[model samples]
Structure formats: structure tokens, C-alpha cells
Target: MGENRIQQNEMSRRSFIVGAAAGTAGLAAAGLFSGCSAQPNTSTDNAEKTNSPTIPEEFTDGVYLTKAISMHGPINVKTVIADGAISEVTVLNNRESYVIGEAAINSMPQRILDSQCIDVDCVTGATLTSMAIQNAVSEAITLAGGDPGNFKGYQSPEPKEADVERECDVAIMGAGMAGLMAAWKLAENGKSVMVFEKMPYVGGCMPITSTAWNAQDTIIQKAWGTEQIFEAWSSVEAQLQSYREGRIEPDNPYYNPDMPFITPMFDAARDATDMMINIGVGFCPISDWPAPQLAPGAFSIGGKFCLDIVKNYLTYQLGVEIITEAPVTELVTNEGAVTGLVAKGADGTVYHIASKAVMLASGGYISNNELMEQYQPDELKFPLMGPPWATGDGLLLGQEAGAALETMDQGVTSHYSGAVSHAEISYIHYVCPGVVVNGSGARFVSENMEYKQALRVFKDQPTTDFYWVFDEVSRQGMVPSGNSYRLDYTFLLETGDATEAGNYQELAEKLNLPDLTATLDAVNECARNGAVDEFGNEKLRAMLLDGNMYAIKVTPTPYIAQGGLKVDPACHVQKEDGTPIAGLYAAGDVVGSVENRDGAMYRIGLTQAIAYGLIAGETMSAEL
Candidate 1:
């Protein structure tokens, strides 16, 4: 109920700016925005331009423009302007959505240019392009004898109110499940908690997310009947205990209070649905509930559950109010102690929400072009998939408040095809159902690895381009499962770039395999054997085959940056010098995850969020 009120009041902040900037991009040559150059003479002196490397005669013929473009990486570095001279620039080359980028470019004026460098920000996913255009404008100023750093057009908006007035026991930055869960527990303990969200809506990335889980019983015994489920769970529990004592330590990333300690997680494959159900979430219970277990130690869960509904239910239960469209502009501190946030509504009105403590759940920079380039430069080859509002707002806010960022090397990303299936929607899982073939048209990966491992397998492939081939039967038979849905053969042939073939031989021919006969024989043999059985074939085969055949050219699309604000086990945002920032806390996606762990998102991971957010809230409330 509070989500609606916040959305109404904060209407302007909801639209994400990410991915709205550019159309798609190709592998080679990127696109640049063409507009009136910022009156360069206002900022840089012509003398300064010549003092450096003189523009060659060849470079002088045209204006040099720079544009940041999006590849698979959240941000990519590409120069539309070559040799610091304007190469005739065109907006059409970028393959991302053109409307967002074109609109920003068209609005680029001397007045706007005067305001800030790349301050307008690009749409999410197309961050590179946005930065490129911003740089291009700045470069133009440098060329025209204006200081690139001196900009004057748009006056930055000021905060609506000072931060010293408001007060709360706990302040949460997001209204997502984790945040709500934390608030619920804290409020029950009598904490005055408030939530701040940049979007009008409160749910962070969950409304559209598909929810699936792995449980202790589901994997150990492939039984769907609820009756036998507990026994299977007990068995898993026993095995996990053994593993914990033998291999996993209490502090180990995978250690879960719910499961027995085990070295190999595969031994305890149980149904994740049981746990989610216990937590007040629902899932489809058909045999799919106890979805097939991946290889030993490989676990998975998949179900379609809209997050919007989840958010509504959670808000009602938590009794915590949310403020949406209120992008936090600053962190207020006194005497080197954290206090609260300086935020602005979409209407440009700002306010200070004082709090005993603050949790930065504002998400990451997968949508920030400038930050993306500063981090994963190599990922520039793929298009981005992130919420536009995910523009490092919380990260910057935390940093300004004396919080130090960490894990620049890690990001919350998984793999997808080169082309984005849907940029605006969050639930679209781009798993292609066809047989994966390497550059040599050879199948290299096990068909039923866990989604993370499956994605990594493809990522670790020698060639960037692979093909996903499936047939009509395969499509219809395949169901949308997991947080990200996989394509069944039918879906592949009907939509997307899947290659259509009449028969296995024809499909093999289309895929450019070395020999159609050999490929077909191998596939048939595997199918007959019920899918790579040596690796647990039936469950793998059930998810792999659907028929009549189609294929999609696949490449690695990295989403989610794994690293951000460094927080201790207690969820306290820390400084680079290793001191906790007073009155500041972090949770959910904005916080750094357990280090060096591949299975960070499983049960133990969410437990960490819940535990830390609880600690922060409790500590803040106690102080109050």
C-alpha cells in the first residue's frame, strides 16, 4: 500500500535511465552522437590545444568525436573521434534502441553542455554510448580552445533540504524482499525504519524475477510427492553434515545452518521449493517442483513468480513505509559520523531523512557507462542488461559518506546470448534450448550443469560464438523455469535467431558442423542413452531435447557487477582504511558478497543479507 503512495509522489524517479540511451551495437566500429558542439571557446583556450600534440592536417579536416558504446560489458571504451579529430559521426551504427540515445544527443545543447560532463547520464546498458557522447562533447570543447573540465550550461540541482532534521532508528535504501524482511524484523523490535528507493516502485529487481530454489530433499530423491520429501531432506541433511565436518568449515561460504556440512554440495541435492514455501513464497509443485537434479553437487530450481505481488504482500506484512522516486543525492554526516541522506524527489524537491542508521541497497553500476569502462573494459563486447536507475547512486552516496568500495574485480553477472532478448523486462531468461556447438561445431559442455556452471562453461569456451540448435518438439516440451527462463525448442524456432531446419542432417548442415552424419549420430546416441548418462542423463535429457530444430548464435553477455561497497559480516559499510562508517550500513545487491566463493547466491548468501541487515537495524535501533 505504501508503494503506491511513494510512486505517486515520486513519479519522476521511476523511469530507469539505463539501456534507454542507445540502439544495439555491432562487434566492430561503434556509433557516435552528432549534435551542435558545445561552444568550446567558453572553456578551453585555443593556445592550450596547439601546445599539446598538434592536430595533424588529416585530423583537421573534420571534427573529432568520442562516444562510449555498450558491448557485452556494462561499459566499453571506443572512440568515434579518431586522432582527437572529428571523424564524420553517425548515430545509426549503434544497434541498441536508438530512441534513448538519439533523444539525449538531440537535447545536447550549449546550455546543457554548460551544465556537466556526462552528467545527464545514459540509459542503462547503453552506458558506454552515453559516456562516449559526453566525452565527444568535452573533446569538442578542448578543440575549440575551451577547458574540457570547465562546463557551465546546466546548473546542478541543489538538495531540497538539509540533512540534520529528520530522524529514524533504521533507514533502508531499497524496498525489496531483503530490505523489507530486515525492516519487518527491526520494526517488530520497535525500530522506526524508513525505506528510500530511486524508482517509484519499491521492489528491487524482484517483481519480474522468476523464483526457484534448491532444497535438501529435492535433489537427493527425485520424488515429487510431498509425503516423501522430508525423508529425502533428512538424508540430504545427514550427507551435508558429513561434508561440513570433512570439507566445509563454519565460516565456509557454503555453510548453511539448515543443511548438514558436506564437502561436495551435490550429495545433498534436495528441493529448494520446500524452503521458499516455508518463507511464505509459492512455486509450481508439479514434478517440476522437485526439478531434476543437475550432476552430483549440482542443484537448481525454477518457477515463474511475479515479484510485484511479492512486494505488495511483503510491504503489508512489514508495516514499513517506502519513499520512491526519491533518489538519494548525498550522505549527511557530522564530526565524521554518518547521519542520514540528502535526497530529491522526481519533482526536484529534496528532503533530508535523518536516521540512526542507513542501509544502501541501491544496486550497482552495470548501467553506468563511465564506471563500467573504469572497471570491466573487456566486457565491452556485449550489450548490457541492467536497470537504468542502477547508476551507482548508492555506491557514490556511500563513498561520499566515507564508505570504501571493494571487489572491483567481482560483479553480479551471469551469461546470456550476444543479443538481448528484452532490455526493459527483468524475467526474460535467455537460455537457448538447442544443442550447444563450439566453433568447431563440437559439443563440449555437459547439458545439465547448474545454471551458473552452465553459463561459466560457455563463458570459458575457446570461441565467443556458439550455436544453440533445437527443434519444434523441444520448444513446446520445455517450460520456463528458474529465475531466468530457458528456451525450449519450440520457443527458439518461433522467436529469436534460431536456425530453422527440416531434419537433423539439415540442421547440422545449417550449423556448419564438420559432418552432418557424425553430428546426427552423436546427438541420437546421446538422446538414446537419455542424455550424457555418465553425468546423470534422464534429468539432463528432459531439459535438453524438444525437436524439429532451430539454432541461435550465442556469445557471452555479462550482467551484474559482483563487487561494490565493502561491508563486514555485520553489514557495516567499511572504509578502504578498514574502519566502519558510523551510522551507515549496506545490504542486498549493493554490498560486497562473500569473497572467492562460486556458490554465493545459494541459501547461505541470502542468509547473510538477512543476518547483516538485521544486525544493522538492531544496532541502529538500540542506539536510538
Candidate 2:
């Protein structure tokens, strides 16, 4: 099963007890006497005495819930209107159903605060806990002598103006595959859609990124196959065959979608061969050559053209409105419902649109320095490679409306062991002979294993630090399998950060290797025997040949933020105590990721982003 499905099912029953206890405590202290109106007298004093406002060890300095309130029965509770805004209810405990509690708590506060006190529906499976929290908070507020008649505890942000007031059924926040796919679906259904992008162009980290879609493809035979094409495509055909069989299940480490997904890649490749077609704003054909010549035989079968071409054709020819240089700011809520949003223009003006629902398709927080510290403080020290605009605006907007954050600790960043400021221009080679050493300068794993497997061994190693040691032979040229593992030679040669020595002894000395001779002996032994001593893999033996050598230090980097407005599968942001926030939903990377931080799955992050965006958009559009 996928990581998400497992998590959804694994939420223990203890969460229900915690939520129930908290609600009971809130009611007893408020002296509501089972649905009776709370009095502003000594009952609150007794309650306060029983439930002192002391911070628990788990929620030291952060904002946390300290109470839960439950009603006698499931009540169609109208949002508490206070000061023209809806009310917010914070759950003090974890006594409700796991997924339901989280989803409801995350959604309720925002809905109450935004709607200014109106009736809102409860999330499925969490209605009892939701009512308990809502009624208790209501009584608690009344006991405190606060105005409960007006949207009680919600505050609207100061209003801002927009540079453009264009109208669309859906306004996407990013132009990446997820956002683009959303626009395509909505547009295909005859719904007007607008895509806002912060980058100068489209393709959020995909154009230059090397990854395969996870799908199943049917093998096809072409009658006009040329020798050159056959030679170049044979390896790819074999790989695809492996994918078609049970060798590639959804959770497999090397699962790549073969059928429907690969079809797009091939289509994209074919489109690339013609006069570069316009896919979206700011995209062009990367090459104008025949498919077979793009790369050597089967090894050259990277279906870049397939995805790019389909992406381009849909954006340009399909009626998807993609507007670059726009960033969303405040969300517009009325009567505890999210109706639209306001985006900021490059000229410093705010633009507003009133849609039936809004989807947060913005990327993650890898690019935001402050957001990085708030969510993943340990990663702030490393060099970042994700796009510069992923500063957690989506998170901030959702939070402002009472959504709870989660995860805050899951991302897949390039791990180069050598001391370099930027990512290597090419993919790290799995076969290239190199020494994998921990921060203690000890060879910990086979240098020839898969990158994911190798890195997993070193993740919890002291300080999460490691380095890749290699000779010049493996670094200077293309190894077998069409992979260029070489670090930028010019950068290495010019900078000298990559140690240079005529022999292994000098290279070992510079790297502070404990035993230079032993490391060399192991490399040669592994090469001669066609096996890696630490991890047995034939692919490694072929790649690590003789070399002068290089070593690059790598520190762990977080590419995704796991925390943000907790939401249900339907994308409704929930409160801390299991109530739905009215009029708000979250999608894409800003929400808690479906994958665990250390799981072994291919395209997990991107796949979830696409799936959530797709589901959220469709749901919101259906509401329209």
C-alpha cells in the first residue's frame, strides 16, 4: 500500500479518547450543565482551577490548544459571529478519531473566522468531536464576557487593491505539471481557468529535471522502424518491458509509469522533432533532430519530448490561460466560506477574483529562508536548489484562516558529498567507482549501490553528513548507461575543491582517509570480482574504473515542508480539534505530504502533488 493509505488507516483509536476527554473537561469547567447557557460566574472559576492554563511539554512556545468542548448531541451549530467574523475553536487534546479529528480541527477554525458566524457542515466521521469542540468554545467565549453575537473571534486582514481584475472559474497558483494539468482538466470541461506564475516562464522544475512518470504502457511495433532507431531504442524497450511486468509495482524503488505516462513522453519527443511547438507561455522546442539521433540506442530513449510537447500543445492550443508574474496573497471569505482570492502584481498592486472555491497550487517552502527556519530548521544551513519562489505563501494564506500545519520534515534533495555551493550539473552516477565515507572519514557502504539505498544508510549517521570519493577516470567521461556522473569538470578543475593527485595515496591523504591502501584495495578487489564488497550490485562494478579522483561533501537538504493546514482528502483545511474551516481548501506541496520522509518510492512527491491538485480542483469546480 502507498504511504498515505497506510497513515490514513494507522491513526490509532487513542486520538478519539484524547479528543473526548478534552471536550468533557471544557464543558465541566464552563458549567454549561449539558447544553445549558454558560453563566459568567464562579463556574468558570472552578473550571479554570481544574484546568490550569499551563503549557504542556509537547507545545512549549508554539501556539497550542488547551481545551476541548463537546455538546450533548450532534448540533447544526452556526458559526459564532463576533465582530463581523466567524469564530475559531481550538481543540486542547487528541481524543477524536485520528484522520477525522485532524481534518475537522484543521478546517473548522478557518470557516468560523471567515464566515462571521454561519452554519457550516461537519466533516464525515468527525461530527461528534466537531460539535463538542464548537459548543465548548462557544460557552467558554460567553463565560469570558466576549461578544458572541458578531463573528466573535475572527479578524479580516486590511483590504488591498489589484492590478488586474480578470475573471476565471479557476486560478492556479503555479505553472508546474500539477497546476498545468489542473488547468487542462478544468479547461477541457469548458470551465474558464487562469494560471498565475511567479517564474518568468512555465515548467516548475520539470524542463531540466530528470525523472520518469509511474505508469503502465503497452508495447507497440512500428512497421517503418529504421536500424538506427532500433539500435537506439532497444535498451529502452527492454527497460519498458521490465516496467510492464510485475517488476515495477507502485511501491517499488524503481517504479516508472510505462503505459499512459510513457505515451506522453514519446508524444512529447515526437513533437520536439518538428518546428518547436508552443506548449505554454515561454516554452520552445529544445531540439530539432530525429528521435533516434537524440541519444544512442535504447539508452537514448528519454521521453523528454513526449511530456514537453503535450504540455506545450495543451497550454498554447488548449484554452488554458497562463499568466506569469502573479502571486496570490489574501484569501477572500464571506459568511465563513472561501469565495475567491487576492493576488499581488509585479507592480505592487493586488488583484482580486471571486471564484466559487480556491485551490492552493503553489509550491513548497524550499526557497523561503524564513519559512525554512519555521518548518524545517535543521535544513536552513544547506545550499538550496529548488525554485526560488517556494517560500510557503500557500502555507501562510491557509494558516491566516485557521488551518493547522503538519509534516514540516520531508524532502528529497541532491546529496553531493564534495564541498560544492551548487548542485552538480549532471546526475550522480550509481556505477562510477567511488568511496562512500561518513563524516568520521570511514567507508560506510558500497560506493556502487543505488543512490537512494546508499543515502538511506547514511541519513541518520552522525550529523547527516557524508562524501562521495571518486577518481578522475570516472569523473572526466561518460560511463556506460548514458549517465554523466562527472561533476562539472571546469568547476572542479578551476576551483581545486576536488582534490587532485597522480595516485590514490595523495587523494586519500587530502580526503583524510584513515587507510589509503585499504580503500584502493577494496576498489580494485570489487572491480576484479565484479562485485561491491559492502553492497552487492553488478551495475557498480561496471562504472568504477581507474581514476585520479574527486570527493564532494554532501549535507542533508530538505526540499519539502511537511507542515501546513491539515485537510481532509477533499482538501478542506481543518482545525486543531477536528472541525472543518469554512470556505478553505489546500492542495499541492504546501499541505502535509502523503509520503513519509524516508520511504522508498519513485515520483512520490510529484505524484501526490499532481493527484491532490487534480482532486481539489475537481471538487471545488463541482461546488461551482
Kindly list the per-residue Cα lDDT of model 1 for residues 491-565, writing each as its tens digit.
Answer: 323224356766666766766766544654667677666665444535433222234665565555545666678
- The Cα error of candidate 2 at residue 489, in Å, is 4.9
Q: lDDT of all the models against the reference? A: 0.49, 0.49
Report lDDT (Cα) of residue 121, candidate 2.
Answer: 49
The TM-score that candidate 1 achieves is 0.59
The best candidate by TM-score is 1
Error of 1 at 147 (Å): 43
Alpha-carbon RMSD, candidate 2: 21.8
Segments in model 2 whose C-alpha atoms lie over 4 Å from true places: 1-163, 218-316, 409-414, 439-441, 446-466, 476-490, 526-532, 535-547, 553-556, 563-565, 568-585, 597-604
Q: Give the RMSD in angstroms, all C-alphas superposed, for model 1.
A: 14.8
Cα lDDT of model 2 by residue, 30-90, tens digit: 2221232344546776756544433222311121222432211111222232342333454
